[model samples]
Target chain A: MEMYWLLGLPLAGGITLAFWGHRAHAPEINAAFSLATLIAAGWLTAHIVAEGPVLIGGDGWFYIDAFNVFLVALTAFVAFTTALFSRPYMRIEQAHGRVNAARLRLYHASYQLFIGTMLLALTTNNMGILWVAMEAATLTTVLLVSLYRTPAALEAAWKYFILCGVGIALALFGTILLYFAAEQVLGAGGGALSWTHLNAVKTRLEPVVLQLAFVFLLVGYGTKVGLVPLHSWLPDAHGEGPTPISAVLSGLLLNVALYAVMRSKVLVDGALGGASLAGALMMGFGLLSVLVAALLIRRQTDVKRMFAYSSIEHMGLITFAFGMGGMVASFAALLHMTVHSLTKSAIFYAVGHATQKAGTQVMEDIRGLIKTNPTIGWGLILGTIAILGVPPFGVFASEFLIITTTMHQHPWATPVLLTALGVAFAAMFGRVQPMVFGETTLPRLPHQPALLPVFVHLALVLMLGLFIPGYLAHWYRQAACLLGG
Target chain B: MSLTYHLQVVNLLAALLLLIAFAMLSQRRIVGLITLFAWQGAALATSTAIVAWSTGQHHLYYSAALTLGLKVVLVPWYFFRLIRQLDVDREVEPMINIPTTMLIGIILVIFAFNLALPISQMAGTVTRSTLGIALASVLLAFLMMITRSKAIPQVIGFLAMENGLFFAATSATYGMPLVVELGVALDVLVAVFVLGIFFFHIRETFDSMDLKHMERLREK
Candidate 1:
């Protein structure tokens, strides 16, 4: 019943937006409704932590364990905040004549449906169904990405569709292979595709076959996770799409996709007699992506594109943490997932305002944001500091945990990571802070959002840096057990 | 060995698929590529039917039917319409020339067969040897995507690769469920619609469907 609300509420919101969201008041109402939903989601996630794993259907089809509940809560929280961010953003687009009532309605509808599919993908316990839901999420976003119908937006949507379509096809093939291996043990039926059943039957599944499937699955879904060598589609998608879509792309969608990969990692690690080789593979890719993104961030002049790289960087760090594969590292990875989603979306929200106010995404041209729009200027300032992993931000806590864990496991790997982090920190913040503070003040803008969501997200990051709630910490410990198991 | 007999036949069919896929890869004319794709799809449909008949999985006939209708008939029809509407009979040719693409296709075949050897050994199916050919066809299609400088040929590459996956599915497990086959067929249909729109958009944006020109449009 509770899980139904978790999936159905946003779906209902999506339907309402589709049918009747054209009125001027609809955006405000949608914003408020989503916020209430987020509060409920927060409560439900907290309950899951207190009660351990919650299985809502037969065969544990909708399991909310510690590993995922935090993600659900974080997803809802960012989604709510982004919705808040979108209310002002869309109105600004409206007033500027970029979007009409119809486009706004379409945007709201797709946003909710997008959130729904992502939630479905994360919560479902059937691997086959999980793959299908993830693919559905991809398809929905293709439409959303192309919602503007401009040529570049259309092309960006096409690239995203083709690359991700092929990726999902490979993932389906991988899922099939996994079922084949399960047929040998669990028999050739639906039981082979169920996550709970596979977890139970992992010992009996064939190692070679499982290894093959794992490779395909990782490469396939890892495309969506925006891992290097397979991340080409990401920047274009983020750069060309609307700001709200960019926020969702970085904050929720990518994290959900990584969650899929991590679940598969758990199964693969179990199959391969633990995370020995898998750890090496993930760490190698993670480090490569980190280096690539750090180098790429400085070269980018588009602010949205730059933040997109920051997203890639943070995702790389999380991947590295998980790849390190200890209980401590996995816990840190989950924590980082939560914090990164919040910080990145907040940055995007701030960037959205800056892009509108200065009327450009390029860094060299736009300046004097501190003089022009103080709320947005301060948001960028704090978002940069938080994103750079300053000591008093949530990102700092996660980064410190990951580095300390890496130090224990492979001490030599630490310096390389720190160097990459430092380079990225310098590259991102150096440009961001100056762009906000430097010369080029223009005429003041007429409209700005209520700064609550930005402040709330920044405060959460700050609080996470300072302290974690007791239950969340306990949940992370238990979730780490699941990761190790 | 009686066991390896079906393997040999599967290997032969796979080779045929790869050869045609490579031909499609090198083919400069849009009409020629579509014809190659049709042949590839026909091969896939036939192979799936053979596997299903031999395995006595009646549902596979449904899979074969869906493949035949969607890949062979419907998609090719759409491609022709798209080709006519787009008026792009002469392809711009890929970044790589014909000889180069053919050479890459050969390497892909060798790698695919090597990759398939162990998996085919484990499979109980008589046609398991075709896995290599299916993989080779897939790789060839990927090579086609890499070489082609036009938007439509890339779409064809995508369609042809789906053919390879279908063949592999048939050889490995008889076929996927009827529902899955239907879903993929619908997906291919929708994908066709989407690509058709993209073709017009690409032409409008850059005045040519040449993907190389659009590379300039990549965000710096």
Candidate 2:
């Protein structure tokens, strides 16, 4: 019963928003539903931490685990915040009349469905079901992306759909290969498709077949992770979609994709004597992505696109942490995941407000924010600092951990990571600080900023920076150990 | 003997599907592209039917029937309607020309064959070799997608890629489950309908179906 509400609250909000969204520009509805979800997520998070993983069954095929509980809570939290953020941002949109009730309905519904699909992807014990859930996520996001009905939005949606659809079809092929490999070990039938079942009998799985499946799964899901070469959809999706959608794309969607890649990473590591090849691949792509995104960030004029690239950079860094294959690095990866989610979401929320305040996403168009709206200006200033890995922020802690881990092993790569970080830092602070603090007289704005969600995430990020909870530190330590790096 | 007979027919059909995919890639005429896509779908339906017959899977026959009806008949009909309604231009200016596309198609075939080598060897089926051709066709269709300038041609390219995927499934594993096949068929239908709507949307925005115009929309 409780399991249903874990998925239902956002969905119900979506339905209600869709039905009466026109006459009723109800930020209250958005607030109410989202807050309810956050509370549910908080409850679930505490429950899971206290009680181990709470298993909700989709008949016998599905069950949640500890890993999924964290993701579900994260998704719900980020979503609820984005919704709270959306209340103000979308009303400005509503005022702009760029979107009508129908479009709002689409956005609301697709947002909930996307979050639900992501949670479903993370939780379900069945691997095939996981693939389908991810596919559902891809499809739902397509509609949300095209909601603005601009030509650019339409094209972005089409590109996103085609590329991701093709990529997911490849993932399905990979899943089929995994099933065959597992069937050879576990015998044919549903048993072949269950992750828990496969993990139990992982030793019997053939190394060569699993290796091949790993390639397919990586290339397939890596596209979603916005790994270089397969990352074209991401910038466009983030650039043209509504800002809340951008927040979700950066904050939640990318994490889900990385989580997918990590799942396969875990499976192959257990099967193939450990994740040497996968680790090497992850490192190669991760570093390359960091280098490329770091360079690319220097040239971006669109504020949204710049942050979109930052997302790629951070995800790259996180992937590199995972690739290093040490307990510390893995812990860093976990922390980076946490800090990055909080920080990036907060940054996007600020960027969205900045865009609204300035009447454009172009950086040059938006100036003197500090002179105009100090709340959002400070938000951007803090976010830019937090994202760039300034001291006493959670991002800094995680990034330092990642760097320290790199220093212990791959000393050669440390300079490159540092260089990339320096470049990214300069490029980001270069554009953003000016917009936040310098000059004067930007346009006056009527939009309300949701003070709570932004502050909540920032406070969390700050707290992590200031103090590490022993319980979470222990949990992550254990998880990293279990991950064997 | 029945198995061999079915195998040879499926193999021949798979080869034809690849050829059609290649032709669609190189073809300039919008009408011709749509025709080739229809032909590819017919081949897919035929091969699916052959697999069904040899395997004695009753559901596979339903898959073939659905493919035939949806891809070969209904989709082609819809394209014709789009052509008539849009009534714009005949010649499509591809991003790359015929010679280069065919060259790329050949290279993609080599890559596909290399990719399929191990997987095909593992499969204990007569149509296993066809997997390479199916993959090649899929790649070739993707190449078509990258090359084409017109919205209609890209859509055609997309449908042909789906044909390649379907053929790959049938060749590599006899076919996906009935539910999956039905889902894909429905997806195609919905996709085409959506694309039809998008075509009008694009036309209303730009006054042309040429994707080259869309290059202007790309971020500076």
DockQ of every model listed? 0.29, 0.29
lDDT of 2 by residue, A291-359 (tens): 889998998999998998999999999888888877899888888888888888898888888887777
Docking quality tier of model 1: acceptable
Which regions of candidate 1 fall more than 4 Å away from where they truly are? A9-47, A54-61, A100-106, A147-155, B1-16, B89-96, B176-189, B217-220
TM accuracy, model 1:
0.92
Residue B33, model 1, lDDT: 83
Clashes of each: 0, 0
* Fraction of true interface contacts that also occur in model 1: 0.07
